[model samples]
Target: MRENSFEHYYTQKPSSSLETREVTIRLKNGNVYRFISPSGAFSFGKVDKASRLLVEYAEVEENDRVLDLGCGYGLIGITIKKEHPDITLFMSDINERALKYAKINARDNNITAEMRQGHLYEPWQGYEFDVILCNPPMAAGKKVWQEIVNKAPSFLPSGGKLEIVAFHNKGGSRLEKTMKEVFGNVRTTIKSGGIRVYVSLKF
Candidate 1:
């Protein structure tokens, strides 16, 4: 069974057995994060495996402005800021509770992130990101998924990267095609279990 099902993950306040659990995450690249699990982010979470994989593989440069789109509990944004220190960080989520958790997590981790509230990239209408990392909500259905692909490019500066991790079963192939149409090139950077990470540049 999927521990973090969309039904459970979609709720702003999750009342799951996994709720209130805390997990210590030590990144391979030498950052440590203590995350409050089932905090409307991941079930049984130290770090969701996909998230761990994304951070592990992607190179986070110092001073790069990053957007953690669909930030959940702010694990990704806070971790990047804490590690690099100089990188600009922004996090956004449609669920208000998710944003609340992100802020709490940031404070708990002693990291600062500009928090935005909106679906996907709506909060940053005119600005561009140096790097955007997303673990998109495929279960939000086709229209929502479509919007994510369609709008992702607008958030990037010329040559900026959009990186996404998605389950292999969740129309990830379709997403790849859509990303190519939007960004001109899309390629898989890594794959493990049923998740694949795709990176593309906007130019």
Candidate 2:
């Protein structure tokens, strides 16, 4: 169904306004991109802080299949492909507008990637990845957050890293426990910047 407006496609479903705005992100490499922003989507005006860090430190290897969960506008996926040039990318988002922009940015950046619109992994069922880079939507509340984490592990291969970054106050500690349940080890990197990146391997 074509959504009327971005009433947080994740939360409510649709809005009346249907207004579109321009959201620009300045990447770490000084590359700037502007995309049509749908109202009521997460971080509708700017690049989210936690996601900024995810793209900042995202690492890729040749031919690695990378998944960008909650990939708003394809920033993480596009950036990774630009830097690495050989990694495969798959972008998924709940917001239809976000997914639209992801495709737009991918075209603008000349990156070939598979775009999937689904709640977490519904689109990639039975598919495995070498890396999963996600800035999860913790603001959606606990149940939703757990849904994302619980389902993310099945997509990762053994020794593959599930790179997740989130706002420090938004149940960051709690996520570590969930990570441990799926993966034996959960390492936190950059815990001092009001954000944390939890790197977990599915053993």
The numbered model that scores best in TM-score is: 1
Any residue pairs clashing in model 2, and if so which? Answer: none
What lDDT score is found at residue 51 in candidate 1? 81
lDDT of 2: 0.76
Task: Say which candidate scores most in lDDT.
Answer: 1
For 88-200, candidate 2 gives per-residue lDDT tens digits of 88888877767876787788778899998878888899899999998877656678778777877788787688888886676888987888886778888676478988888
Instruction: Quantify all predictions' global Cα lDDT against the true fold.
Output: 0.77, 0.76
- Report residue 17 deviation for candidate 2 (angstroms): 3.4
TM-score for candidate 2, please give it. Answer: 0.86
CA displacement after TM-score superposition, residue 93 of candidate 1 (Å): 0.7
In terms of lDDT, the poorest run of 10 residues in model 1 is 37-46
